[model samples]
Target: MAERCPYPFPRPTALGIPERLTGIHDEPLVPVVLPSGDEAVLLTRYQDVRQVLTDDRLSRNLDRPDAARISRHNSMFQDPRINPDPPEHTRVRNLVASAFSAARVQRLEPRIHAETDELLDAMERSGGPVDLNEALAFPLPVRVICSLLGVPDEDVALFRHWTSAFLSVSHFPREEIRAAMTEMSRYIAEHISHRRAHPGDDLVSAMIRAHDDEGRLSEYELQWWCRLLLLVGYETTATQLGGGVAMLLSHPEQLRLLRADPALLPNAIEELLRWKLVGSSVSMLRYATDDIELEDCVIKKGTSIIPAADCANQDPDRFFDPRTFDITRSDNPHLTFSLGPHFCIGASLARAELRIATQALLTRFPNLRLAVPAEELKRQEGALLEGFTEIPVTW
Candidate 1:
């Protein structure tokens, strides 16, 4: 029997696409062991990754008795929205889709700007040498999501704790993961009950109306939807924000270009998204519903396939000078946000937050520089998310 490839596959560095991932483009699919100790096929090439992501035969139904999981801990808390097929997935996604539509996200821009400014104000007051992750990157997204969810100020810390614990896949014990899930579920349930009694303009209250008035959403679906939104809404944005800042700081020329021309902010954010490594090396666990043939291999039914978006984003075939950090690069079709039905719903909002936060930081702290050597900067290890644990900086 062939040796089973270990999960994560060993990256060359803490930053950028892993060299191992990019080096495997010639192969159709590589073997890997998931955090759950399940052996799976890992797709690296841009075409293969896109094919697997778009193929309906490759399902996200992790609730199956024999579903493959990224980790044992994730198995216990798979959100139905993430693991179901249509019409169930369709139903759950549609109920809250409008809430995240471009129009809705645009309406929140003023609020996002205000929040960004407020956080920058706090960071500025802290004098020099502050961790941007704690002051801005982390808190900004959390505050926005909490406000949208109608979560009270006192409970923000609790939600953060739960989310941090929940994403710590291989790092934390299984019991801790379960405990965080329990507390998060309870907290959402309680707040949802409150929203039912006293409706508000917030997203949670709107979801409650969908459940009570329209009957479009069930209680179980509603709770998990809130949990999914809360966890994803902030987590991805927070990590990306920190990574973006670090990326800019690391590349002074790009930072200078961005500061000289703020019009580049939008495209710069796109490049940043394309360049940064936000999540795990692998995409979410997708199980094969039936035998599926690719260029060089057949994925047996029930086999899990993880498409490495990090690799696809930097695939040399798809991206010219893929490794170069060029803010002006166009025709850059990166899969940092995986494609298909599961494409990030919060993409617009995330873009807005990153642009606003980047603009705010550059405009406010004109001399912002890393407080420590880039190599010395710490990162959150063993979590599904990949980002700096703390980005210490001074202006």
Candidate 2:
């Protein structure tokens, strides 16, 4: 055994990376007791983490009796339909891949910009010291994704409630999580029923066609697509936005540089993605189908592995002065988005949102500053996507 520490070492500060996860470990593969009480070998080095992502033997299906549960109750993690491997994953992923393609996301750029402005206008009219997360970060992604998915924006709050509950492992009780998941599933079913009777150009309507006309998707898979798409399309972007804004506000020097050159918007977004915008981890756990060998130890069959992308992004071997947040970092190949077939489908869309939102912020609120000190800011810990719940700001 290389070493096993309780997983997710505490951050030195709210906007800072944990020291243990920041450095390169000689024995990169070490055992870690997850919040769920199950132990899994954690991969921290950039090369190793990147390698594991492309390995076919590591499967995301953790529903098996032998595999470790990421959390005691991450309801989303236990589903085989959530992230099935290979031909199965590729089949369903292909259905919606085009909708999230760079081209499709490009068309949405105008809407994204408009939505970004609309929210900023709202924030401005509301006056200073307002909760930026609630006013802009949370709603902006919801509005854009809803327009893409064909879901009504009226239920954004409902999605937030259900996703928070569904994603949490130790934050909420088991019964609450189950109830939220049930309600979310019912909500998707209702939408599917509506779309079947009255179809449109939106993603949900297309999915309805895939389910009813093409017969490609099972009834369960259809609803699963609707539910999971909505959850991922909103939660990850929202969390990133909150954390990104916080990181910029905390680093005044980089913030000034970004504001001075509007061209750096895309570069800044990549830096934010490379940075841990959420709690501690990036990608989740995978189960070993057979015994696997790594640079350090032998991962026996049935073992659970968590490739910590957040830590990998900070590996000095890959990133020069990885600790420093550089806006002009051109050689960045961060693993925030995993590699191989399981790479995040919504990555382009997420980047567009961050770019548009950040640009709008830099343009409209040139003097944007946090309402409170950086360390005083709060984070939603132990949630499926941990981030600032309320980022109070003033212009």
Candidate 3:
């Protein structure tokens, strides 16, 4: 489990996290001593991560050197997203909340279903051995977001490249990532200008109107939010879709069950999101603002703590049969999207996309099967947003 992660640490994967924390019921949290001579607190217990997320004592600022060292600055965990507390976080979250309300998302179901069918049609027309990730998984979120943002659908490839460069854990260098971010920002800024000149009923135009009318978000806020919406909103869902398909392929019986009864998809998607590993690795790097003591270690102020959400989700105290993947598992409380005040604001929209996606796909192509061996397949490693580079499948 630890060897899979190249970070020179003993962080466990989603599959191995449960077994890693066996018999540690006596302790609430465990201390991880990295090979780099750095110490971090690994919160394996579900309740513990929830407590810390809601706790006022812990800070989420990743720029602090003393904080746990993460590899990248994802928008979700960036300074703007993580540093603020209370009213500020509430303000930012609320401003974006209306953009993804339940009623608004509900209206898009038909269109999403249409898009899903079209993509599936293209895949089926291509015959067997099609890359599901390329065909269905990635395009769903990309097209949805593009439609919502009023961006030209043809530009998806460019933005996709930027999204890849933005959170990529490997291949691209630091300079390359910086350049990609700059180019993406410039493109978005131009789009903002264009939307300002020509107001439309899209998210960017709506935000522009909000800024003009209410004067809520500043330039940075608006730009950051736009970037956040496009990148986080798309990548997370896209990657999760890819990972979900991979999981279903790995468990053919579960896939069969899903095919037999499409009603089980909602809960099944939740379980998959809870169980699957997305992004490069699981380690929350938080700087200690004050001295704190856990079971075995005393972390001083300015020390970094790495809490493994993948591990915490499988805590025995919180989940029954932690290692087993049961879509119908009752009382399943996982921290895949995180918890507390800083919980994912796009939760509802994401779930809707997944539910609509999973159900539509399984119902459309019940014979969908993996075109390649699971172990032989490659996954995007060392990136903030973890997903497959490509998921090959056949119908």
Candidate 4:
């Protein structure tokens, strides 16, 4: 017999966690020690995921406990508002939200369109059998974030490699991840220094001004914020673009519908996000600060609980016909950008980029199709955020 696959994620299986958890199970609350020797409870149900997300007993910042220091580098988990309880998290998040307002994102639409077109133009010139992942998906968000944050375009490729290393889960040594993150921080700090001397109309410059006008943000705070924003800005959106293109290509009929009805673009983006079933694990692991009881079990304090974003999004109870990829799926409430206090700040800008990219892609190459079979394509493995390593497309 073949070796048994790992529990929960259903590696080498068709459906992912949603199926594994909902399938036959021996126990209600399973306990597994992670490679780091940290104890955690892997949740699968929508109700369970939501309860953990909303529960006051659960903490997003595991680094709070002296014993739970998982990483030395500062992380979003360090942002008390993102992962902390009550007033601390609230205060910090309020300060962060000022930088990501709806009005501010509205101004980004034109830039998003221009960036999408530029990439598409390059893609057209490169011709078919092009790797969309390299040509478009990978670079689009990097360029968008660079344009938004005022980072020089030349720095993006190196930063992309650094951020990629930061998020890597492969058997690559932990020290390597740390070094990459440190390099990323150093690079961003240098840019911050440059911007302080000569401010521009980018997000980092705006943040530098904010730091100057009032002592609202510390130098360290600004540095970490820039690093945090850039890492997330590229990694998540790149996954979306790669995954979204895979989804569109997989469902050509939906692409046809989208091409015919450009008005359906917004809804289609939601559907695309839902269809991918990405986010195999939460970006940040939430720790139970105290004993917390759900319908089935009581989670002990000091334990980590990772909410299944993909599972919750595909929960049949929450979403009707959870498997289908309908471009016009009317009642799409995906947690892809997540929900509540920890929701993604750049969602509007991300949406604009996706909308423009998708619209322009189908318009420019109406006959776009995969150059190879789906099974033949390689997906980047050993990482929580997954996408095609190279999506070769022919038009």
- Best-fitting candidate, scored by TM-score: 2
lDDT of 4: 0.69
Tens digits of per-residue lDDT, candidate 2, 1-395, equal: 75668777767777877877644466677788888888888877888888878888889887798887768766456786555888778888999898999999999999999898888888899988889888889899988888898887787677888878867868988888889888998889898898888888899998788888899888888888788888878888888898898889889999989878878888889998998686666246898898878776676788788888877888888899988999989888998878888898999999889888888887898889998999988777787566786888998
Q: In terms of TM-score, which candidate is stronger, 1 or 2? A: 2
User: Residues 203-297, candidate 1, lDDT per residue (tens digit)?
Assistant: 89988988888998887889888987887679889999988888889889998988888888888888888875575655467888899887867
Write down the worst ten-residue block by lDDT for model 1: 74-83
Give TM per candidate.
Answer: 0.94, 0.96, 0.88, 0.87
For each candidate, the alpha-carbon lDDT, in order, equals: 0.80, 0.83, 0.70, 0.69
Candidate ranking under lDDT, highest first, comes to 2, 1, 3, 4
Give the alpha carbon lDDT tens digit for every residue of 207-237 in model 4.
Answer: 7876888776667667877887787777777
RMSD of 2: 1.5
**Which predicted model would earn the best lDDT?**
2
Question: Which segments of candidate 3 are over 4 A away from where they belong?
Answer: 1-27, 31-39, 72-83, 279-284, 291-300
Candidate 3 C-alpha lDDT tens digits along 24-47: 545555566532344565655566
Model 1 misplacement above 4 A:
76-83, 281-283
How close to the true structure is residue 238 of candidate 3, measured as C-alpha lDDT? 86
- Kindly provide the TM-score of model 3 when superposed on the true structure, using C-alpha atoms: 0.88
- Positional deviation of residue 261's Cα in model 3 after best superposition, in angstroms: 2.5
